[model samples]
Target: MVEKRATQRHRVFKGGTITFENSGIACTVRNMSEGGAAIDLDTTITLPQSFTLLIERDNFVRSCRTVWRSDRRIGLAFVQ
Candidate 1:
């Protein structure tokens, strides 16, 4: 398979939150890079087109858009 990502992601296990419209859902950061991240949710649910991703341990917060999704996992692209 061809590597299509703009930046390389590092495997990680970090707590994250997907926040939108005054609501937040818990997620697990499975892999991350400067450009984007892959996250896993507890259950399959519909998320907004765009949302904020927060990783408290790293003091990270960024606006993200859904790039792809399958089951409980989601691919996100950081929005500038």
Candidate 2:
């Protein structure tokens, strides 16, 4: 099955961290837009059903929600 995603994506890479219910892991912001972001986390870090993503990019700290996830990665979207 093909996954259909919104096409308004921005090619921005930023460094950040992720905190889940039980653990906190370091991740990288591979690409991001106003709507969502693609993050690269460790393979062993299991993403929770919902979690907070703390993004410290270019002197801006933004928090978002983990909306979708896979084995070693996750998709985050703005909360508000």
Structural similarity to truth (TM-score) of each candidate: 0.96, 0.66
Model 1 regions more than 4 Å off: none
lDDT of 2 at 24: 69
Q: TM-score winner among the candidates?
A: 1
What's the distance in Å from true for residue 1, model 2? 8.5
RMSD of each: 0.6, 3.0
Q: Pairs clashing in candidate 2?
A: none
On lDDT, the leading prediction is 1
* Model 1 agreement with the true structure over 1-58: per-residue lDDT tens digits: 9999999999999999999999999999999999999999999999989999999999
Q: In model 2, which regions exceed 4 Å deviation?
A: 1-7, 20-23
What are the Cα lDDT values of the candidates? 0.96, 0.70
lDDT of 2 by residue, 9-39 (tens): 6776677777666666788888777777888
